[model samples]
Target: MRLIPTEEQRELAATVRSFVAGRVPMARVREIAGSDEPYDRTAWTRLSSELGLAGLAVPEEHGGSGAGFGEVAAVLEELGAALAPVPYLSVAVAASLLVSLDAKDLLPGVASGEVVAVVARSDGPLPAGRIADRGAWVLEGVVERVPDGPSAGLLLVVASTGEGRRGVFAVEAGAPGLAVMPLTWFDTTRPMARVELGGVPARLLGESDSGAAIDRAADVASVLLAAEQLGGLRRCLDVIVEYAKLRVQFGRFVGSFQAVKHKLADMHCVLEQAESVVRYAVWAADEAPDELPEAAAFAASYLGRAYFQVARDHLLLHGGIGFTWEHDAHLYYKRAKADEVMFGAPRVHRARLAEALGLT
Candidate 1:
């Protein structure tokens, strides 16, 4: 598989970066994050529908660009760098889940960015949810910490079925007996909510045994998220380096000091390693599905640690300014810390990696 970006992918990444710079800069991020709104509707619509990014990985038959994960990863990276408060990651995860389930009917709206979907997490196999067929599929359960739950038009829930099997189900956000209550989270940039489904009509997708499908979705989510972490790490390095070069101490540039230089260098080393892992995972997502599990696990574990470390160092090196809420450093740091455990922590992923490699 080509780990290097092709010309088209390069253009796509550049365009996405430009869009982040022009539309979702830090000022806009703070505004949107601080507000009660789910996200920047205008910017998200333009990005998903106008730019057709929402369908970058959706098949053309389903109204998506028929592109692949590589392109999706590109957009994700840029969004990570900007800390753009959009539900693109949630949508992407849902798309991956749907694809694994071979459910293409929802792809049209998803590709068009007309329908926003987020995955609701359960503790484990049908942990606290049940599905019964009463002329129509109905779900009853409580899923907590659902990403983008408040803003999502649709929710893809992973629940245990009556057959003692795990399955994925879809429910409309406005469906009867469904309640999505927003939760106060550390990362204001990514919203979470608790969803209570009580006799809510839903659509069941995928086969009865959806374990593999769920794992695939998780793997894809991990790889893409790691790509995002890589972006955040890169941004942290950039900001810290820039600050070091400018900030003067005792009439000398801070970067010229040995201690500061070593810290920045260590961050850069981690950033470079993270870039490699994320890129390999991106390639495996499309070109080598068999390897995606291991690749994604590695990326997830490494980038989680890498981004948090760099973000921490970024804040520390910024002196007192970084500690203040006014600076963007804290935001990045929060995002990094939040992301580290968004899909289980680095330790969890390391265990997964070990299992995948038969090292357990």
Candidate 2:
């Protein structure tokens, strides 16, 4: 796999970085985080219509740019760095699942960002609902901690339909007996919600064995999420380093101290390692399909913890200011913790990695 990004990829990353910096600056991020709106719809619209980000990975026939996961990774990385409050991850995962299921009808809407789709899967011990059929598929039960659930227009639910069969069903938002309630979360940047399905009617996306598709989509999301984590890791390190260089202690730059230098070096090393793993995961998503499972697990397991560590250390390096709500450091730190548990906790992914390697 190519470790170095191509020129086009680099340009894509640069464009996303510039757009996010200009459009969703930290001030705007803070504003949206506290607002009642699920996210900044205007910015999201621009990301879709102007940047064509929503369709970055979808095929052209599906109204997407047909870009590979590498480009998607670039976009995600910038979004992570800026802590942009959007439903990109949720929508991307849904799109991937729909594509795998050959649900082309939904793809065009998702690609155009006209539809906000999210998957109601497990979020660290949260169980999915069971699917009941009454002439049509019906979903019953509650899905806890659905990322961007309250704002989504479409929901791809993973449900169990007796006889050990698992399926993925597409349910319209606000369907009869479906209630979406936003939850108070630590990471305000990415809001989550609870979805209550009381015999809600849903259309099955594909044939009965949708469990595999959900798992595959999760693997893809894991890789992309790791890329996002890497971006946050790099940004935290940069923030810490910049502060250390500017802040003075005892008439000398704090960064000149041996302890500070050593900490910064370690953070840089970790960031570099995480970047390499994320790059490999992205490449695996595009080229080496056989290696994707293991690579995704490894990236998620390793980068999740690595990014959290960097964010924590960045807070510490900033001294007392980092703990304050006004500081951006805490924001990245909160996102780090959130990302770690979003798909699965680091230990969960590590166990998956072990199972993949036959070490279990």
Candidate 3:
């Protein structure tokens, strides 16, 4: 099957790329990355109100534009390409869980682009759930590193109450027992946080006993992340190709060299393969039930890691200038690295794939 994007999707991609270049320019990304708040509300509003990006993947029933993961993925790719600073992933993936599971009341602000929502999934060995005391739920645990936590108005935390209990909870960011502290992260385009939930009030989402909903949410997140990585990887190739054509070494354009040409060709091949995988994964996420896990696993383990490696390779091709703090290539590199382990590392995802395939 042909892997090229359809006219409409290409249009969508172009629109997103243009908007990011115009509105959240690279300079703005640098400014926010070095700032105390780091989150850009103006850029977020542009995505929500002007671009309708916040609702791209949300169902229509929840006041969203009623698009699917594929559409959302297309937009995310552009965001990654530009290293645009926005909370699209946290809202599209984390808050999407709430919307998908009939938790609509908690998401209109996010869908409308008025508030940012983030995920606080704990990294401890324990299972996931809310902590309750005296009949009132209180979140009291350490959520290792949460994305977009510093700017979010709501946090959907996945925690463990016991060995087998795992659940998703919605807690107001400013709730009495909650503390969100920004963590120094590698990817300035996306911020990370350490959450201290000490007796924070929470409301449970999805079925009381089943962890299926949370698993589905995770699957959606993994697939979307793969799409973002695809965009970043593609951009890295583009950056290298442009540089190779312009830069001269030994009194000849770098593109004239066989080694540079071979590397660019290899990068193109890897990016194309990853694009197809991400598209398939998004389709499986929306259509196939039993296949979702396998698709998500393939995306996380292969596409995600592959993209980061490609970005690093592209940077190396640029030499000393690529390593500088002012270079945009480093921004993409940081995001690519951060995305590799966002949902789960490649090794962890490969284990999941093995289990889904009945491979001991």
lDDT of 2 at 336: 95
lDDT of each: 0.87, 0.88, 0.81
Question: Which residue pairs show backbone clashes in model 3?
Answer: 127-160, 128-159, 128-160, 128-166, 128-167, 129-159, 129-160
> Against the true structure, whose lDDT is highest?
2
| TM-score quality measure for candidate 3 | 0.94
Clashing pairs in 2: none
Query: What global local distance difference test value does model 1 have?
Result: 0.87
Selected candidate, larger lDDT, 1 vs 3: 1
Q: Write the per-residue lDDT of candidate 3 for residues 1-360, one digit (tens) a residue.
A: 333456777798899998998988889989989888657788888889988888776677676888766678889899878778888887898656877668878667778877678777765653234546766566677887888888788888887756677777788878897888999898877889888877778887765543687788888889888888888898889889999999999999999999989988888889878988888888887668678889999889998778888989888999899999878878888788898888777999999999999996
| Runs of candidate 3 exceeding 4 Å displacement | 1-6, 126-134, 161-163
TM-score of each: 0.97, 0.97, 0.94
- Relative to the true structure, candidate 1 has a C-alpha RMSD (angstroms) of 1.4
lDDT of 2 by residue, 1-360 (tens): 487888998999999899989888999999999989889899999999998999888999999998889988888988999998788878887888888999998999999999999998855333334545546777787788888997899988888776666788888987998899999999999989998888888888898777778778889989989988888899999889999999998999999999999999999999989998999999998999889999999999999899999999999999988889889999999899998998878899999999999998
Tens-place lDDT per residue, model 1, 1-360, is 688878998899899999989998899999989999989999989998779999888888888888999899888888999999889999998987887788888888888889998888765435334445554677877887787888899899887775667788888878998999999999999888988888888777877568889988989999989988888889899989999999999999999999999998898889878888988999999989899999999998899888999999999999999999999999999899999988888998899899989998
